[model samples]
Target: MLDDATKAKWYRIVFDLKKQFGKKPDMNGLIFLIGVRELGQMREFAKHEKMDLMHIATCKLLSYEGYYKFEHIDEEGWPHYSLVQKPPFTDLMSQENRLRKLIVDYYEDNGLFEDMDQA
Candidate 1:
């Protein structure tokens, strides 16, 4: 469980990223952004490809929890993950909490918060 200070810090980080991007990104949007960054291919995506990107992000996040496993990147440069176990959350709030933890874990793991002074 996250302590109060840690939760506040995450909220601040999310808010700051929202400000930086000049929009209030919802959970899905944040995941998409994270997915795009993970994709490492800065280019336009097709309208139908957004869901695929989000799936990629979801897989990436869930992998840390042992629900997925990272496989090799394909020739197209997209990363693939295989299911290792079922997702840990079921209900709406629980799912949201899990995603929040995943987001914070992503930043922390990648040192994305090391220079987060603006928040």
Candidate 2:
């Protein structure tokens, strides 16, 4: 379960990302944006490309918490991360909470949520 601080942080992240994008972005959408930012390309993502982008974002988020490890960026600039630890939560809701906590960690660790905290 996510702690109160994590839930609050997640709420702020959603608000901030929505403000940045000018619309409400769901978990997948926010992760896709993070993936595109990581990929260093903001261009339109095709349907197939979006899947890969979401995967990249998942890896990126997991890497921070030791569930994955960054390996290398491919020639096309796609990131590759090797699984380092099995995820503890397996159920859908638990998995979602874990991701939410990790996403909050992502924003906090990267200073992305600093602005949110100030306001």
TM-score of each candidate?
Answer: 0.90, 0.85
RMSD of each: 1.9, 2.2
Which ten contiguous residues of candidate 2 have the minimum total lDDT?
110-119
Which pairs of residues have clashing backbones in candidate 1?
none
- Poorly placed runs, candidate 2 (over 4 Å): 115-119
Tell me the lDDT of model 2 at 79. Answer: 88
lDDT of 2 by residue, 1-119 (tens): 98898888888788877787798888788888788878998788799999999988999998887888999999988889899988785898888888898888778777877766676
Question: Which candidate wins on lDDT?
Answer: 1
Give candidate 2's error at residue 62 in angstroms.
Answer: 1.3
* TM-score of model 1 (CA atoms): 0.90
| Model 2 per-residue lDDT at 36 | 87
Candidate 2 TM-score over all chains jointly: 0.85
